[model samples]
Target: MNKNNTNSDSSVKTVKRNKTRESLPPKKYQVLEQDWSINQDGVNIYGRLYLPQNLPGKKKAVILSHGLAGNYRDVTKYAQYLAGQGYVAYAFDYPGGAKNGCSTGVGQLNMSIFTEEQNLKTVLNAVRNRSDVDRYQVSLLGESQGGAVSAMLASKYPKEVKSLILLYPAFSITDYAQVAFKSINRVPDTLNLFGFTVGKNYFAKLFNYDLLKSATKYNGPVLIMHGTDDIIVPETYSEKANKKFKHSKLYIFKHAGHDFKGKYVTRANRLITDFLKKN
Candidate 1:
């Protein structure tokens, strides 16, 4: 009887250990980074692709876009995290997207949202064509101006986009442009705004495009995140944009500003991971 009892206890211990091991998350795959160049209409758009090592099969992919005047490095952390999670991540710079970006500089003097959208499309096409990427599972993640561009792209190509994640999207660009130019017809050839020399084409394009209307066309799963205290892009814009999406979730970080950091970034990453996993 004593021997039987000891054997039963050992069996229970082994079962419990196995169960615990099963409950633990899988080990993260090693990530490799590579530089890629995507040509849009003739301009070289530079980007970084994050690939997971030791993956058994092709994985889902995400194309990340930086905010206005920002480069691919701005979203490197997100790319790294997604790559670790077994998703191939790509971050690209729009032509003249930033003053110091790696892409061919069109200069802020001629940069416009329409041009940026074209660049994004080029990157998406390049990503979709890669054998290691699951074309049907590609998603877009954009910040600020890039968020607006992503939303527009998803709307324009609903069937191609699996999901969208917009962080503090600048949906009020047209409204802000109206305020800056006073009269759209009177926009100068070049004007300075926020320390950047923006061209009249930028304001003209914003005046003609309706971001909210374009966003309404995309009915895919959308994740919109904003900071309540963000002065750059008001939380209300995100709130209003959320109402347009057929399937959308809005997260407002308390006291968080336009840029996320520290605990806030961690929180955002968690929310993003959960959303991606579900969709």
Candidate 2:
């Protein structure tokens, strides 16, 4: 990438390396980063589209979703990697998803799983409608809260999603909401959570949501990765999901936490690419 051209749509072309790690293969094409934004419910959802130069015909695409309060930049690396592997990649910021997000409208006060779900659907439809994308081969990859959103969408539109990949998904959110307030009557109108001010709507749908049940509705292949030491969202949630899905595999990283780190990230990426290729 050219340091001076980072912000331009036609600016960055991923640099290729002569040597590659045994675990990670060399990129197939020079990836180009472009600014791609879409309008949803009268507001703009800012995002980036990574296209592999000179790919013939319609290409398979992947939609990368960030975790709660995270922006598209947080998952930019994944988009670059997938684009390098010959797949078109997209990463976007959800409305009101982050304090400093590029997207407009909605905020922490009213952002909920349901709202995020709608945001993802809008992205999926836009990506599918692209002339260069193979609508039938689009996949969804998400982290934490975004993972839950992806799973729910895959369940609702199984035929549209080729495969699903979840990284330390927040499937326990529904249960956490119940335990936090004990019941709906005890729910407060507003509260500070993880440095964000949230309202009752944040937990409204989650109160009666069944993540695993909704997730298992999608009969497509699913790859679930979780860390054994994750305290924020215990591994048990993923374990349960793995068992419930008809065709799913779960990989547990020894020392990884809520988000992967060090070699864990590399291993997870390899697994992700492999799964996408086979599925």
Candidate 3:
């Protein structure tokens, strides 16, 4: 990205590549360059390590996963805030979402729900094994579909992820597809003519993800944020997800839409701050 129109590169890696814009509020934090790569499975993943000046101790990290079509900078604001609070926040762009600096390809996993899971695992592994900080204290924050995958990862590997902050995450892929179909042309019923039974295109993958089942299995604390007027992801879905969580809390933004901003953003940030501090 052109320096005039983008955020600066502050990762821990020695190599230079696509750089995500630093989050808003501009915390006095520097990004420890990153080592980017696409795994053998063709999942695109990259990590940006952030280090706080004069940190109290070896800083813990927050692995941030972006939304569909969004990049690592998508959550720069949150990452920056975490950094200000003395956490080494790492944000990586995942395959099937936005390709910041990782390999790319077309495959069943990339096109289906499987890509999200694969990318999440790859990113988490990358963060945990990094040389700069403590990985055991690592946590996750995901938006939209990323939220769903993160939830599944936390449930499947409770020993790895301590907690989760899901922002309007898609718990039901089928629900997302159904809402998507309303705006765009609906997929033809015969599209899955071949013995396959899933909806055509994205809908086909939605059937593969079962977030409710995953959440039920996750025994960690979950903070679910959703806008009451989120047309893309109805708030009701979050309501249902909240019930599935044994140790979870929900924050509804009245009159707020998909990506809640203004007050919603402020409160959500505070919530994360509290969760990380207490836990």
Residues 96-215 of candidate 1: C-alpha lDDT, one tens digit per residue:
666578888466677887888878888888898899998899999999889999998899998889999988898988889877767768898887665566787787766666777776
Which residue pairs show backbone clashes in model 2? none
lDDT by candidate, in order shown:
0.79, 0.83, 0.66
Which has the greatest lDDT? 2
TM-score of 2: 0.89
lDDT of 2 at 78: 80
Candidate 2 deviant stretches above 4 angstroms = 1-22
Overall local distance difference test of candidate 2: 0.83
Q: Candidate 1 or 3, higher lDDT?
A: 1
Q: Summarize candidate 2's per-residue lDDT along 54-93 as a digit string, tens digits.
A: 9889999999999887889878778898999999999999
Go through the candidates in order and give the C-alpha RMSD of each one to the true structure: 13.4, 10.7, 12.4
Off by over 4 Å in 3: 1-44, 99-109, 176-201
For TM-score, candidate 1 versus 3, the one ahead is 1
